[model samples]
Target: MSYLFIILLAAVLVYIIFFRKKVVKAAEIAGVNYDELLDVHVPFYRFLELNEKNRFEKRVREFFREVRIEGVGTEVTDVDRVLIAASAVIPIFGFPEWKYKNLTNVILYPDTFDGEFQFEGGNRNILGMVGSGYMNGQMLLSRAALVRGFSSAAGKENTAIHEFVHLLDKSDGATDGVPANLQPPAFAAPWLHLMHVEMRRISAGKSDINPYALTNEAEFFAVAAEYFFEKPRQLQQKHPELYASLSSIFGQDPADGGGR
Candidate 1:
């Protein structure tokens, strides 16, 4: 390669090595309170064995170290930090090497935002949103909904996970609901067919999933991912094929008590 290219590559390698050391040190400092917060807010944390818990904690530490979480119109507490990190950690915990490289910032608002992304005005019930175009690599979450999403034991609504899933769905260049690169080649036809079937069921009001999933395929994927993690057993029972597809996509089975 050219001398300039070699120099740039060396610089990148140095940065990666140094950054990892910093991340580990940061994790050491922040991970001590991981269990404490998980005990209070994360129901999924209770099911994991010691090893899994350790792994989850490591991932959480890494996530917090890598991403920047800031609050708007409110103070961002440790509970908020833990919950936000947990939301990100849960979805990709199966893959140890996986990191949300696309997500650089998480902005939490005091409550629901409006169309203009302000705290008040039209309709005012936007829970979470992943940035696109010029605002890419950013996420916005409602503090109230973020807490409620983890506090609730039943519903399959998680603002953090929902937005993170959208982030994952967007990794392949478009958020069309199909994470084409992540799915297996054989999964292509079956996945599309399942989406159609599920949409039909939802339209007929025979499905228990949120009707908002019907908005589009991208939304369907995000909402389905929320259910896949929150109420895995129920989702599996109601939509076995969808569950299986998600299991394959995520490389983990939450229905099996969150095992990879």
Candidate 2:
């Protein structure tokens, strides 16, 4: 029955265009089967208290209804939809009414893509990307990378979540490491300084953070976020200062394994 529902659901959603990024409110999206999908893929949703779980589901449904997710040269399963929605919801769960006002559509490629958005052929190294310029208001994800992020084989990296954090960082009208709109004004300076310190540690190979974070403050923020959410306990133990600061920034204390 769940399989049948997913097949039907995918059929309906696959044809959905951007439609101005509106929340269609077209009948309902997530349900028992979606819950099962979340339970299987998303650890954050599984750990939520019963009430919080319902709220999480509600947010996921809203995002699923709002964003137009279409496949490019691949088939999108319910698993992909749920995982993508979960990625969007988990970061902003602290802000109940928050929505991705900037993003209207998400394109799923069969695998990693190159700069030109070509998923096949050599040099296809990009796992996920948030678009800009003529391509603004869109996001792209590698299906394989998306699934791997939620699978048992996943480590501290979650490609979908990383891209969402990038969107969050860009929310304050700037792509700088400091999310002025997300974090308190006073903390912006400190956050920038902290990013520098952490980037140096990563550069020196003295940190567990991905070296890619050293690319810039923006990348640092996104990379650290993946670490924060993926292994909160480990982050808390190994990098308590980072954990505390991130908890404040995101309004989420995942280290405690509970919702805000």
Candidate 3:
């Protein structure tokens, strides 16, 4: 009986290994070509300029190679191209584990899509949303919103960054914005304390963080992520302690790219 069980386990392991390999191959076949991806989603020349300015071109290319873009509606535009580039590149500066051989499908929407929400009493309402990201999974975006967010990094909130942050937080299991994979042992006390403090401050309307963060721990993590990447200098300058906590967690420095 034991021998039979061992044989069955070995067969199951082999089957799982084969299945995973097949799935990865299929994903590779469906992946967009590098040149084509650059043309349709982000112009190669523009990326070159960004790379030159930031000295992160090779890293950016490596990151995009792992992502797969899927256009949903009409042909992808120049604006769509730029936004996708930003989505693929910026996150990696903070989350290096994202390179772990997976496909992130980029879904484009012509405009804001209707998102339905049901309340406790069974009342439903539709809300217009620009974009959302699933953990290490897919990203949905609206061309118009993407343009606006990229054009004015200071004013318009970036939904792509916001949603992707949620995914990062969900890496551990729950979407509470505290990804278990990235959490360092040394940061446990400071992270918890500062997060609680910031949450309370936001709740009291004393923080620059979006009011949305006060909604929950997950939203707090997501909203903080948007600010961390988009307004790194400002966040670090104004909230050094909070920035320190974030830096410790992500193991990257946005404010000058040095260890905090």
Question: Top model by lDDT, which number?
Answer: 2
Leading candidate by TM-score:
2
lDDT of 2 at 118: 94
Per-residue alpha-carbon lDDT of candidate 3 for residues 87-111, written as tens digits (9 for 90 to 100): 5556555554465233356666665
Write down the TM-score for model 2: 0.88
In terms of TM-score, how similar is model 1 to the real structure?
A: 0.86
> Which has the higher lDDT value, candidate number 2 or candidate number 3?
2
The full ranking of all candidates by lDDT, starting with the best, is: 2, 1, 3
Off by over 4 Å in 1: 1-32, 258-260
Candidate 2 lDDT, 1-260, residue by residue in tens: 69999998887776564332343334325343777888877999988888988999889878977788889999877788888899999889998978899999999999999999998889999999999999999999999999998877777899999999999988877888888877668998888888888888887889998898988888888899998888899888888989999999889988787521
Q: TM-scores across all candidates?
A: 0.86, 0.88, 0.65
lDDT for model 1: 0.85
Name every residue pair that clashes in candidate 2. none
Off by over 4 Å in 2: 1-32, 258-260
Model 3 regions lying over 4 Å from their true place: 1-55, 94-97, 100-103, 116-136, 257-260
lDDT of 2: 0.86
lDDT of each: 0.85, 0.86, 0.59
